[model samples]
Target: MRLRRDHLIDLRPLTTSPAFARMWVGSTLAGLGGQLTIVAIMLHMYDLTASTFAVAMIAVAGLVPMIVAGLYGGMLADAFDRRRVALVAASITFASTAVLMILTWSGGETVAWLYAIAVVNSAANSVVMAARQAIVPRLIPRELLPAASALGGITMGIMVSVGPAAAGLLVAFTGYGWTYTIDLVLMSALFLGLWSLPSIRPEGAVVRPGLRSLADGWRFIRGAKNTRLQFILDIVAMTFGQPTALFPAIGAVLLGGGAITTGLLTAAIAVGAFFSSLFSGPIARYPLHGRGIERAIIAYGISIALFGAVLLAATFGLLAPDRIGEDSANIGLIALAAVALAGSGAADNVSSIYRNTMVQAAVPDAIRGRLQGLFIVVVAGGPRLGALYAGTLATVTALWFPPLLGGFVIVGLVALLVRLAPAFRAYDAARPTP
Candidate 1:
């Protein structure tokens, strides 16, 4: 294969690895559909309960199960054929979503039923995510891991941006049934993606799936200082920094325009992620990845802080309703929110690119799947826990306080963590001695 320099980055996995490209296509489609159902379910529950706390609990309910599945699923990836493991996980995800859709379709949908099914879906998705992450490095070369990761971020942004906004429109226009059915159709594409990948099995001693395997993976993670520090830093950032749970309150109270504004703000973050990744050639050229992750997450903290500052401004009436995107959103505030979200997205994506590269390049292939499984767990579960935290805190206090305060916490915590662990800070991409 020929290498071409395009912009700041020189590698192009999309053109080189046909298998990776196919997987990306299939995953992207299914992800879009998944988002639609996720948004619809949250909205449906919110409408039924009229309680943001309840909406937050939907995430909370799924957290423990997801964590469990993620841990166990990593073992599965290490023990058996990864493709088969992924297919089984996907099957569970698909079946639960199908159940969710059918119940909503049958007109007997209850909040209790939605909660039950969402927990199942989220847990299964966690396993699929762990399996899929382990599968990606196998499909592409090491040199292109960052680009592949950036592309993954772009995929995430697009799926989240379009799906929820589309879900909102569909639910508002055609009811929840049609919106959910789209996910069912999209999910079928996932099977094709998994089926096409080469059969990937564990490289080293394949321990049977059990507590012993989980402990072995944890030990591996601990011994890898760079990997361990990065995980710790990321956890601190994600655990305290994520502001997604505040969207509903921001729409109704702080930002206005109800669900539409909420969707726009949510989509706005993805817009930032998508654009940032699009121009990621510069970021990919960075020599020091460990330092890059530290800085990017720090930048993310500032951006999220900006988001909170905007809300605080709105609360104090310093920023009027026009920008909030209500029946009368001040165009200036709308622009400001979008800017904040975009900046946050860019910083978060950069951090993700580096973190992903760190794990893929540093970890060995034998334990790689197991390690990646833990990575997936952190990636998927941290935000949900943050949601629970934000939601509970906001329920007790105020919406603006959560993000506003969370931002500062992320900034201080990440800086302290990075300073203490020089290994993560010293992670050089070119020398790459992870």
Candidate 2:
């Protein structure tokens, strides 16, 4: 089991393309800031309303706008200079975040204000994400895509791991205004990154950004069976397996230790993602992306189920405290839950690496933006839907029930869908066919 030097994350992508390197660094920093705001908002919402459903609503509220932005942004990326498209989208994100910071400092922050700002931020970010992803294939050789994606996992790992933990500590000691201010400061790096990039217009036939472009992208997707199936697989895994909406409550009531526990729970997943990418050399060379995705997602589902089992055990008073509260925690149960979550994170990252590589290498550059737009939508939107599912289910049943049931559902549905899509199962990286 000893991993060799080459059996680790390849850093060639950074050296191969300076543009990609700068963008990666900037995006990583900005992503960290974004995570801070995301976790803080959730904690803030829970603090104000003390309702998990209210916290979940923050995501649900932004879903439609995000979807619209993603689709339109993709078209814009395909038709115009991608650098310009990304810059415009980044500006909107920066403005929305500034407003959020201002409201927090002015003591004018209300639930309604948070929701509205969140909606704006989410929509803007979807565009930024679509443009950014669409820009990736143009920056590096196709063979380097898997390595680039593994690098992205590292970026996400740092963002989630450091960001949430820092948010909790900052909110606990320094207050909400300072946390928002820090995020606003970090966001400036994104502008630098996007500003320095050279103009990149889409290759091949270009269609203007409009209804016709949308229909064109749709037509391409209809024929891209592998791409379509991967999207469906991702939706199934995320919708049923995500249990993030319950973190605040889980920390307060189930695991105890309040904001700190919530941060720890959130960070554990990213920790696993980080380590998985750290050792992803073999994964980058793997040719069977479709099968890799299937197997990885199945493992993800199992890990989620294990997490649910841990929560169920806590419910049964196994290694739990007689009296659990914000200050008092069942440390053992918390540890077990973190381990399960970490497993889920690692598995999910593996799945993401395969999925991303497939899309980037297989899809045509002319239409890449539009497909990536749909990709980003599914990635972002699925979690929102999962939050709704988790929040509602937890509200009706118990904190432990949602993940417990949802995990099995993810396993069953993903397996069934893959079985039905033989082409996906046979997908080969050497000759990618979308």
lDDT of each: 0.81, 0.91
Give RMSD to native, each candidate: 2.6, 1.2
Instruction: Score residue 204 of candidate 2 by CA lDDT.
Output: 99
Number of clashing residue pairs in every model?
5, 0
Candidate maximizing TM-score: 2
- Candidate 2, residues 52-162, lDDT tens digits: the string is 999999999999999999999999989999999999989988898899899999999999989998999999898998899999999999999999999999998999999
Model 2 TM-score, all chains together:
0.98
Per-residue error at 70 for model 2, in Å?
0.7
Model 1, 1-434: lDDT tens digits are 12223443334788888888888888999999998888788778877987888888888889889889988888888889999998999999888888887888899899999899889998888888878888888888888888988898888889878987888778877999998889999989999988898899878778998888888888887678888777777777777777776776676667676666667777788888887787788788776898999899999888888887887777777657445534655455656877898888888888899999888887877777778878877887788877887888888887777777878988998888889888777778776765
Backbone clashes (count) for model 2: 0
As for model 2, its CA RMSD to the true structure in angstroms is 1.2
Using lDDT, give the best candidate's number: 2
